[model samples]
Target: MIFKRKSSATTWQEVLEGCLRRDTKAQRQLYERYANFAKNTCLRYAQNEVEAEEMASDGFLKVFDKIEKYDSTQPFEGWLKRIMINTAIDHYRRNSHKISWSDLDEASQVPYSDSYYKDEHLVNITADEIMMFVQRLPASYRAVFSLSVVEGYNHNEIAEMLGISESASRSNLSKAKAKLQSWISAYVIQQDEITHKHE
Candidate 1:
C-alpha cells in the first residue's frame, strides 16, 4: 500500500523534477501542457497562427535546451514564460520596428467583466485575427502593446524587459494603442455595414 502511494508520487512531482534533469519525456509532457498557452503568447508577437505556432515550437525547443539553466527554486511556469517572451523578442528583432517612443501614459484601465456573453465581439473576431493585426505593427510598437495589453506588463517593466528607456516604453504603448484603435474602428464600421446589408 505504501509502495503504491510512493509510486504515484514519483509519477507526479517527479515529472517536473525530471524536466530539471533535462529528461526528454518530462520536457515533452511539459511542452504538451503549456504549448497552447505559449503559442497564444507567441501569437501576440507573430503575424499569424502558423508563425506563432512555429515560434512556440522554437520556444519549447529553447526551454528543453536550456532546462539545465532553469532554476528549480523558481516557479516553472514563470521561467517558461520568460523563454516565451524571449522567443517573441527574437521574432521581433528578426523583423522590424521603425517607430520611436517618448513620455506617454497607459490608456485608462477598463473594468473586467465577470461574465462574457457569446454574442460579444470576441465571437466575431478570432484571436488569430487580433494577433495578426498586432504582429503587423512595427517592432517597437509590437512588444510594448503585447506586453502592456496582453501580458499585463507595466511601462517600467516593459522598459526593463526590453532594455528601453521608460519614456520610450510609454511612447511605444501609446502609438500601439492609437494604431489598434484605428484598426478596431475600421473593423467596427465594416461589421456595421455588413449587418445593415444583411438586415
Candidate 2:
C-alpha cells in the first residue's frame, strides 16, 4: 500500500481548537509542521546550534501557551514565525553588542547599490547554495545582510529593530556583501578549473 505523506492541516482555527481541547497529538502536529521554520529563525539570532535548539524549544512552548489567543484570520506560519523570531531576538538582546565592534558604526548608510546581480538575470547557483555562503557570515553581518537582502528591510528599520544605529546596520551589510562576493568569486574559479579539466 502506498502511504500518503502527512502534512497536518494547521489553520489557526484547527490549531486553536486543538489547543483548547488540550490534545497532545494536535500540539505535536503543530510543532512538526513548523519546526524547520522555527529552527531557521533561531539560527538567525543564535551563535551556534546549541543556542538555536534552546531557542526553538522555548519558542514552541510559547506557541503552545499562546495558541488560543491567535487570530485565526492571519497566516498560521506567520504567527509561529513571529514567536520564533521573538525568541531568538530575546536571546540576542541578552548578550549585548561587543564593545570592540565599534567599527559597526563607522560607515554611513548608502542606498543599496544595484549591481549586475540586480540588473542581469544571472545567478549561477541555487538559493540553497547561496544560503551556504550566507550562513558563514559573522552573526551581526548575517542578520543585517539577511534583513536587507532577503527580508527587504531598510537600514533605519533594521537599526531600530536590532538596537543599532542606522550607520551600523549599513556597515554590517556592506561587510556581509564583500564576504559573499569573495566566496562567489572563489567558487566561480573552482567551477572553471573543473570544467577545463573535463574538456
Candidate 3:
C-alpha cells in the first residue's frame, strides 16, 4: 500500500524537511527552485559559464550535505545564497595565486574621474555588456568586485570571507571600478564613432 501526503501543498518548509530526510524528489525540487539563483551568484564570481556551472553544482552538493545544519528560523534562500557565494570564493582562492597581484597602494590610490564615464552612459549600457566587462576583469579584481558591488558586502566582510586584508578588498574594488570605467568609456567612444561614420 502507498501512503499519500495529507495535503497536496508542498511548501518550502516541507521541501526542506524532506531534503533533510534525504528524499530524492525533495532534493530535485529544491535544486530546481533555486538553481538559477545559485547559478547567477556563481556567475558573478566566475569568469565563464563553465566555471559558474561548476561552482553552482558544487554549491548544491554542499547544500545537500549540510542542509540538516540549516537553521529553520532563517531564510532558506539567503542561507543557500551564502553557500553558493562561499563556493565561488573557494574557487577564487584556489586559482588566485596563479594570477599576479596588483600593487595594493596603487590600486588604493586609483582616482575616480567623474567625467570619464557619466552616470547616464552607464545607465544606457546593457546588462549583458556590463557582465561581459566584469568577466574581463582579472580574477582577483573580479572576486572583490562581485563581493563588494554585486553581493553588497562591506570591505571587512569581504576581507574575512576571502581571507584578505580589508585594505586589499578596498584596493581590488577600486581597481575593478577603474578598469570597468575605462572599458565603458572606450565602448561609448567607439559607438559614437560608428554612429557618426554612418550618418
Candidate 4:
C-alpha cells in the first residue's frame, strides 16, 4: 500500500523512525527532501550531470543501507553529506584509471599568482558561471578543489581521504586554483570586450 502524507505533516523524527523501520514511503520522502542537495554535492566531483546523477543514486543507496549506524549525537544532514562525499570518492577510485593525475613534479612548475581579476570583474561573474568553469576542470583537479575549497577539508584530511600524500593534495589544489584563475581571467576579458562592442 502506498503511504501518502503531506511533507509538512511528517516531522523529520517521524521520517527517521519510519526509515529505520525500512518503510518505502519514508525513504521516498527522504529522497525528495535531499536529492537536490545530494546531486549538487556530487556535481562538484563528477565530470557532468549524468555522472552526478549516478553518484547521487549510489550515495542514497549507501545512506539507506547504513542508516542504522548513524549516531544520534551528530546532525543527520552532516551524516548524509559525508555519505555523499564518500560515494563521490568511491566513484573517483573506481574510475581512477581513466583520470590523469598531474605529476607531483609538474605541479610545482605551475606558477602561482595573485587574483587574476579585479573586484569589479568578479562582481560581473555569476556563481553558476564560476561553477561551469569548475566543472570544466580536470577530474583530479576538480576533486581536490571541491574537497579543499568547497568542503573545507585541510590537506592532511584530504590526503587521508584520497589516499595520497599531503603534498600531492596541496599540489592538486594549487594547480586547480591556477587553472581556474586563468579561465576566469580570460572570461572576464571576453565579457569586457563584448560589453564595449555593444556600447
Candidate 5:
C-alpha cells in the first residue's frame, strides 16, 4: 500500500507514511536512520556492546511490527526512543533476578565541594565512558538512573514502570548517583596524578 519516496532525502514524515503502508524500502530506511539512536538507548541499560546490539535489534523489530499504532502527531523520534527504552526495561526485568539491590546511604550522604565535578580532568572523559559506568550499575539502580536522569521520568513514573514503590525508585536513583560520583572522583584523582607525574 505504501510507495517509496522518490528522493533520497525523504523526510521522516514521508518515511512514516510510507512505513505505515508497509513499504519495505521505507522500513529499511527508517531502521538505518535510527539504528544508532536505538543502540545508544540500549547501551544505557545493557552491560556490554553485544547486549546493546541485541536490544536495539529487538526494539527495531517491535517498532516496525507496531508501526500502525504510532500516532502521527507525536514526535516520531521520541516515540521510537520510548519503544527502545521499554525494550531495555523488558530486558532488565527478565534478567534482574540475578542482581541484588544494596543500600548505600553513606555514599549518598557524602558531601563534595562545589568544584569537585568541575575538575579539568573530567573533560577528557568520553560519553562512552560515562555510559559504561551507567551500564556497570546493578540492574535496578541502572533502570532507575536511566529513567530518572536520562529519560527525565520522575520517581512515581519510574515506580509505575518498574512495579516498585516510589520510595524504592527514589532510593535507587540516590544510590546510583552516589556510586557514580565516587567512581568518577576516583577516576579524576587517578587522572590528575598521572598528569602531574608526566608534568
Candidate 6:
C-alpha cells in the first residue's frame, strides 16, 4: 500500500489515539507509516527478507497489543525500535536450537577487537553491500554483531538479551568482525579488478 510522507505531530497523535481505540483503519495507517523502518530494523538480525518480514509482522502485533504501555512523552520511533529488537531476540531464542552457538570456553579463545575493517575499504562499500555481508554471517555471530555494532549495545547487555555469557558475546562479535573483514576485503579487490579491466 502506498503511504504518504510522515504525518504531522497532530495527525500522528490522532492516529495513535485511534490505534489505542482499536480502529482498524488507524492501525493500517500506522503500519504503512512505519513498516519500512520496522522491516529494516529486523533485517539486521534476519538472514533473509522473508525472515525479516516475519519479524516485522510479529513486532507490529506486539505493538498493537501493548499500545497502552507506550509513553506519550518519549519518541514513538525509539519505542518501536526497542520492540522490534526484542522481537528479533525472541525470534533468535525460538530458533536457537537450529543455530550453532560457540561454547564459552571456545569463545574465550578469540580476542575482541573492532579495528579490522580499513577506512579505505569501507569508503568504497555501500551500506547495502555491508548489510548483505552481515546477513551472510552465522546466526549467532550475526546477532552479536548487529547488537554490538549496529545497535551499540555492550557485551553485558547482549549476553543478558541472548542468554549467553559476556565472553561468548565478545567472542561471537570478534569472529563476526573477522569474517566481515575477509569478505569485504575480497569484495573490494574484486571491484577494483573489474574497474581496472574496464580501464
- Listed in order, each prediction's TM-score against the native is 0.70, 0.77, 0.85, 0.89, 0.82, 0.90
**Alpha-carbon runs more than 4 Å astray in model 1:** 1-12, 66-75, 90-126
Q: What RMSD does each model have against the real structure?
A: 6.2, 5.0, 3.8, 4.2, 4.7, 5.1
Candidate 6 local distance difference test against the native: 0.91
Tens-digit per-residue lDDT, 16-74, candidate 6: 99999999888998999999999999999999999999999999999999999999999
lDDT of each residue in 1-199, candidate 3, tens digit only: 9988698768998899899999999999999999898988888888898989999999999999999889999888899999999999888778767855566788857876646555677866788788889989999899988888778999899888888888888888889989998898899789889999999
Model 4 misplaced regions, further than 4 Å: 1-8, 114-120
Stretches off by above 4 angstroms in model 3 are 1-9, 114-118, 193-199
lDDT of 2 by residue, 52-154 (tens): 8899999999998887778888887888888887776666566665522325545343233448355422366666566677778777787787778876889
Off by over 4 Å in 5: 1-11, 103-124
Local distance difference test scores for all models: 0.73, 0.74, 0.87, 0.88, 0.82, 0.91
Our model 4 lands, by Cα RMSD against the true structure, at: 4.2
Instruction: Sort every candidate by TM-score, greatest first.
Output: 6, 4, 3, 5, 2, 1
lDDT of 1 by residue, 1-199 (tens): 4554444334546677788788888887788788888887777777677988988999998988887787778887888888998888877656535434445444323222213213354467766566667887876888888888778888788888777888878777766766765675578679879999999
Report the CA-based lDDT of candidate 2 relative to the real structure: 0.74
Most TM-score-accurate candidate: 6
Candidate 2 local Cα displacement, residue 106, angstroms: 4.5
Q: Residue 21 of model 1: what lDDT? A: 83
Winner on lDDT between 5 and 6 is 6
Ranking by lDDT: 6, 4, 3, 5, 2, 1
